[model samples]
Target: MKILFTSFLYLIGGFFTQSVAQPARHRAAQDSLTAELEALRVQGHFNGFGVAIVSGKGVLYQQGVGFADAQAGKPYDLHTVQYIASVSKTIVGLALLKAQELGKLHLDDPIDQYLPFKVRNPAFPDVPITLRHLATHTSGIRDNDFYLSKNYYLRPGLPLAGLPMTFDATQTFIPADSAVSLPEFLRNSLTPEGKWYQPKGFSARRPGELYEYSNVGASLAAYVVERACGQPFPAFTKRYLLRPLRLRDSGWSFRQIDFARYSRLYGSTTVPLPYYATTTYPDGGFISSVADLSKYLHELIRGYQGRGTVLGPASYRELFRPQLAAGNFEDRNERNPFSESYNVGILMGFGYTGFIGHTGGDPGVVALLFFDPTSGIGRILLLNTSYDDRPSEATMYQIWNTLEKYQHRVGG
Candidate 1:
């Protein structure tokens, strides 16, 4: 009995030693990665950005470098919140599936069944557009010039003259009071009978026949979910998605989160931009931090591996299943890891190299979220500054590639 007890003590000590050694190694790797990223940020053009490496189990590494508000000397850290642009569409995709699971709606059902106003392609009026068509970006809806002009509004009380105006003029901001409801905005943008309607708003292709990415189309899908579930889109997502994941810092609007942690967006490294909100909020308006998003990415990785908690294995399978063919895209971006256009699974994107994720760029924000299925590793990059020049764009890719280099080390 004395010999057996001695053996058990030896095993316990070995177990603790091994566990301690693992974290010590991880910390060393993390420190090395931090140094490299800091060097890259100093040489790069963007003012602030954050990165996260995640796997099926949990977040491996997450850090923010540079300034979230340079003028104020605020360090951009893992908790700094900012818009993630079109990556928000993935949430819409998940919500749609969750709605379907609850028997609130079906993907195959025509969108007209839920919308208050009629929506049809003027070029193909006889053909019906289904929820699946919207989810897959084959609804034949187009974001005409009016979309850029009418969709963005400055948050009330922000002075316009203080903001950078050098980007696309259509991205210019309007007064907050002028903003309309999502349903009203879609009605005006899509129906021929409304004021903002242009024939160009509906693409020449028939619904579900071509892959034309449209922000309006994505918002429309969210609206359909809103109507079918009989709840506001924001509330529905909060109840079903954000709460379950404990993403307290993520939301569609500034009102939903702690305003103090929000990062200031920039048009250029030196040009601070005023806060603006999109009327089509569902398309590109999710605000989150690397810390929160790292967890979300872990959940996604788990979902892909059939071990997710937010949705059933069957729902996740449907979410990630490739819904299009090579013929779906008239011009597929096969080489870019950031391009979600290679092929689509619901609203999710598959890159040429089998990287499943999405890319987003709004006026002053750029974001990339992708996971490699083969290794079960995922990456998230969120920048508060726009890449308006070729050098800046290259730097963006460099930062992403740098993360790729250290992912294995940090995650191991």
Candidate 2:
């Protein structure tokens, strides 16, 4: 018995020794990554950004470099919050599948069954647009000029002159109070009976025939979730997705988060953009941070691996299942590993390189959230500045590529 007990003690001692050594190595790798990222930031055009390296196990590394507010000299750290633009659509994807799991709706069901108003492709008014079509960006819906001109509303009390006019003229900002509700906005933009409707609001192709990325279509899917589940989109997502993930810093609007931590967005290092909100909030308005998103990405990685807690194994399978083929896209990006347009699964994206995730860019926000299914490693980049020029855009890619190079080392 004494001999057995000493053997057990030695085994325990060896375990502790290895555990301590692993973290020490991890810390050294993290420090090296941090230093390299900081150097890249100094040379890049973005004012500030946040990053995370995660795996199915959990967050491997997370950090923020540069300034959240350059004028104020506030460091953009792990907790600095900002909108992730279209990356928000991934949460909508989760919500849709969760609602489906609860028997509220099915992906193949025609959207008109849930929406208060009817939506049909004028090109094929007889063809029903399914929730699946919407999720896969093949619903034949189009984001017409009205969507660009009317959907964005500037937050109250900002000096208009200080906003970046050169950023995008079509992304016009109106008064915040003038903004309509999501349902109202969707009805007007999509239905011929509504005022903002355009003949080109829908595509000529039949539903599910072509892949045309539409912010309006994405938001409409979320609205369907709301109607089927009998809860507002924000409330439903918060209850099922955010609360479960313990993403305390993420929400659909500024009101739901600590506004003080919100990073000031920029068109460039010198061009600060005024705060704005999207009526189609589900498509591009999710506010979050590197620290919180790391956890969410970790959950997604686990979900992809069939061990997720948020939904059943079946739902995760559907969520990551590729929904498109070569013919779905008019022009596919066959080269860009980060291009989400290569193929789609529900709303989750598949890159040409087999990376599964999404990429998002708004006026002042650029975000990339992708994971390698083979390695179970994921990376996130959330920048608070726009990369309008080629050099700046290349720098953004450089940052992502840098994370790619180090993710395996840090995550292992």
Q: Model 1, 1-412: lDDT tens per residue?
A: 0000100000000000113446676777778878988887897588889988888876777889999998998999988999988889999999999999999999999999898899999988889999999999999998887777778888887677767643565566777888898899999889988889999888788899999888899999999999999999999999999999999888989999887999999888888988888899999888899888887888888898999989999999999999999888898766554455778898997767787878788877888888888888888888889877777777877777777777777645
Model 2, range 327-399, lDDT digits (tens) per residue?
A: 8889886865445677899888777778787778787788877888887888888899987777787787678
**TM of each candidate vs. truth:** 0.93, 0.93
Whole-model lDDT values for every prediction? 0.82, 0.82
Distance from true location, Cα of 74 in model 2, Å: 0.8
Residue 410 shift from truth in candidate 1, angstroms = 1.2
Alpha-carbon RMSD, each predicted model: 10.2, 9.9
Flag clash pairs in model 1.
none
TM-score of 1: 0.93
Shift in Å, residue 235, candidate 2: 0.5
Worst 10 residues of 1 by lDDT: 6-15
